[model samples]
Target: MKLRNLPPLALAAAVGVALTACSPSEPEPEESAPESASPSAPPTSEAAPAAVLPTGEPQVLATGLDVPWSVAFLGETALISSRDDGDVLELLPDGGTRVIGTVDGVVHDGESGLLGLAVDDQGRLYAYSTGEDGNRIERYGFTGEPGSLALGTGETLLEGIPAASYHDGGRIAIGPDGMLYAATGDAGNPDDAQDLDSLGGKILRMTLDGAVPEDNPFAGSLVYSYGHRNPQGIAWAADGTMFAAEFGQNTWDELNIVEPGGNYGWPEVEGIAEEGDFIDPVQQWSPEEASPSGIAVVEGTVFIANLRGEVLRAVPVADPGTATEYYAGEFGRIRAVTASPGGDLWFTTSNTDGRGDPSGDDDRLVGVEVG
Candidate 1:
């Protein structure tokens, strides 16, 4: 069922309290060295200016969605997945919506529900959802004909991934090699992040049919990398460099340059591990500043959707240390961000998801000219 109009104040109030109380805690401060004693620091080479991001007000594309989580393009239209409900909706060009189909057996709870959606080169649709067995991925055929847009019965591509009310990492994407890649959480078990045998807290690389790719770092295993807490965003640059955004415990959130079999220090270390086998995040943010969710890469820049920060962050792929925040607190808890076929950036708000204060026109999909 479509969700329209703001929920009752009582209901909204109760939900907001619960969500706020359960939100991730602020990160602890790290120790650092003192500043140089020299009267004047050495001059450094000037860096290039950041690329211009989309400006002006965002055009609302579709509204009245029930916790839209992920968006994928299907020809000219875009397909959106609702997290609380199993509905897969089509965002039409005229700013209308249509229920293409709903996934079966989705277990909607706290943070576990229908999550990520991806479209392959062959027009096949892949979705990640929490189910009775566990977190799973399903592949379906899509028919995009006008007035007949629909999704067929899904075939389970992968299953048995860990699931929990929180930390159910459920972002799926098609990599440059045409293989399917999935990011999974630690299922609320910190130890799982360091376990190589478990699929939790790791990125899985597999064929479309769920078989482990031969070139995978761990032969015959789906684990691409280990020691991830709860990664929710993954994107590839033009040069095929992969990047992922991860949630931290009570410390730094991370944006990492994903490498094959790379170990991202999690429970052992939150953000940067100055000296260890673990790789440091290319960029890190305080949990309060960035509960980063969905991300998109456009023209060598990474656009990150911040849940708590309520903003869109643009980080240059060449120099990730330089990040600029945009649309701060104007949209109310941005959840999903995707690059449109026309090179614009499309993002969805999560205000009506029982977390943030819902505006009159909330839970919407908005477009901004990024190109």
Candidate 2:
């Protein structure tokens, strides 16, 4: 069935970069203009956000990203990113990249492949990927060697997430309390979102090692919240409020305020409801305008990358309940977005990975200066 025709909950089920090895420090804040001011037009050249950088040249953080899917910074000098084609890259201090390893047998058909990535206080790297049977999460040691990990040695930290050629949930991040947080899709089964035990269409909170956390809202279960159709972006701003970006069934894709055990109105509700036991979106936009993916919260603004819109969107968060958007269209087919140590924003382009045509540079890691 087409997405637009899907039931209110059906759309809910559907659906980064750096290189520095430095000390862990607080994320630099992203700047925001007055909410009432109009957004500046996109730059004609490959330059960073002039608002963030008066010098105004978009810097190439890394290149040859190989269908880059997700990214997370390890420290100020080094960062890592994974590709949909199964490759993982490490960006070093020298501004060059090296292949750390390949996620073997990642089912790359449709939208399923190597997706979300995260790291813990212990420095172990975690990833969400399409396994042979379903989507899985695993962890590896940080050896600093490209394509040289003990690939077979990493344990499957979590397994049995529902997987379809499409709707496979892939975003993973470690929360402040040392718990792993993940956003899952509906696996094309609208009703699956309402089923707490199915592991599909839910936001899960688990241990860094994959055990269910005892304090989880659903006691003895990994489900932190239920009733999500397909959530693509997850982030925690300096204030620690968790926010998610989700693709809609057809009408409105959403940026949501996520809480433990919160029901986000998937399968039965989309953006907001006239009346329902579900949380509402802080920000909603047309699907064509923003097929939102990975999200990063710097200072108070949330930077959302778009696959369909092919631009980077900034949402200023004065209040948790509402925000406005700023569009910078310099990047085409942006798939992942993150923050850098030098007070800049980083993003990846996914044009050559099958969604659209390559524009000069098929896939590149670019940086945007922000407040």
Candidate 3:
């Protein structure tokens, strides 16, 4: 059955390298990736018989979001996070929205406002947002039912992640392993990306209780991988192949197949270097065309939301080297994309965030059926 756009539409819109291993305290910044890395896991490709992506136009689900940054669903109900105001919105059936509640202690800055959101199996809501101190992760009790959703008191899970107006990489998701994963930027300090002790410029993995995973690449540390500039997207395939999308300085943006304890070259290198020391990106695009952010993988296809590129890009899991573009310049500044609970693809726009030209309903939530 081909899913068509909702009939009663008010408005609609749509949408890393590794570090090398090195010696103890003397580990050089330019060292190649660690030796424990499994060979670069290739994306699921056409050869693997991946499903085709939907070409139909996106269907608008809701409108009037204030600089919305991320979206997560609890069962059938959708929860959206706003950056400027730190409001969590519940999407209504009539293409409208209502405020569930505002998150506490959110301090909005350039790109350092309320950002990523994730829901756990225990019905807990984990939020990654910027606080007065820095970027932090908090767990909130998700209470009440849908439509009447409310947030209970929060427990701080982690804090003091580096924050900057521009490079505050803030995106969180739960891996198939049921662990909480966060992508953090370099926080405007490139050297921090190479420091294993620094939380910036790396993908972090932690238990639900905020403890570092014992099996992490680094011992007694939450840093799963390091040497990233501004990684904003991370997703895993059914086979557990991890993929990440990152922003480059001025040359390139990257899509990488992540490896445990892998080191992706950051200030040392931008795109593919073919250097054995650092892991290379599976694909690279010019920054003007691919400031990629939040991404999702559905049915062996990796869906990416590009900010400046202003397009939704799809890459086959088996063939991550290439991508197909959709809705280019139709809806301004695509921000986040997620697999909807209804088996469709849901995405949100970011035009109202002091950038692109937004319509009356500039920041909107939209979706498309994918089967």
Candidate 4:
């Protein structure tokens, strides 16, 4: 389920009150999360549930999760996911979960929490989360608690991502050139969508350590592309071109090619054929068809996870930047999806947190073998 709150974030008020009432000083950051390899990634409290995959499934590689948010393959047999609350779990193909510990102090208000996640080529796990301050990306060692990873001190990989009740941009991924690309939301400020200085409402490319890559569209800056309302999902095909999925205000949602310095009109434009120097969406849809979130391009197919639509929509990408939808309506409140090693795809459902009533299970992790 998604969390909803008022626009512009009442965080300053809420945080100030919390601080004055609690600790007056800046809160100490959490220690790195510790990793565990006990076969599964679930908290020890719940017993493993039965594995559930499509009937003609690829042998249901695994199952039994506690609100799995984002899934990324660790090796040939294991993967990792984050619980909506704060717990991170490492799942095994045998349907078992091991609690890898929690990312402490993640303000789980509304549509925020442990949202977007990625494990880079270096085997480092990166998580874009809602900290007490706002939204940020933190990197971790592949196997431990938040503090145990390389950036164990919770070093800010990227900071100042806009986080609101409903439209917090949370997805992030490492591109082929070793730069970290992130999708961000407008934080309910339409004007902010056009502001390059504000980190909200844009796609940013930065170094793994949060530093601006030298060759970024804007020199010494992180903004790779701008003009987005709530760009939540990002993906890249084999050729290294980038594409992003955006949430619309009311008119239409969009899928756009993320070009360097490109502005895909927001506030200024909503759906189709808008004027000005803005790039239009390659495809558009009503919110019911694609309240899209996490995205993964597997074997030329863009797998987009829809939060409201409750489906996994696939768009085939023959050219790196262009695509056309091929499959839709196959999942339920899918919040996160990713391509696993060896050509399999993993997706998570979001029915428990507060959306539609989960099918008794609330949330789940399913594997898809894409063509």
| Whole-model lDDT values for every prediction | 0.80, 0.70, 0.81, 0.64
Best by lDDT: 3
The 10-residue segment with the lowest total lDDT in model 3: 13-22
lDDT of 3 at 203: 94
lDDT, candidate 2, 181-221, per-residue tens: 99899988978899987999988999887998889998899
Ranking, TM-score, top scorer first: 3, 1, 2, 4
Q: TM-scores, in order shown? A: 0.86, 0.81, 0.89, 0.77
lDDT of 1 by residue, 92-159 (tens): 54456789999999998899999999998878899999999899999999765855699987999889
Stretches of model 2 off by over 4 angstroms after superposition: 1-55, 77-80, 144-152, 320-328
lDDT of 3 at 297: 93
Stretches of model 1 off by over 4 angstroms after superposition: 1-52
RMSD of 4: 16.2
TM-score-wise, the better of 1 and 3 is 3
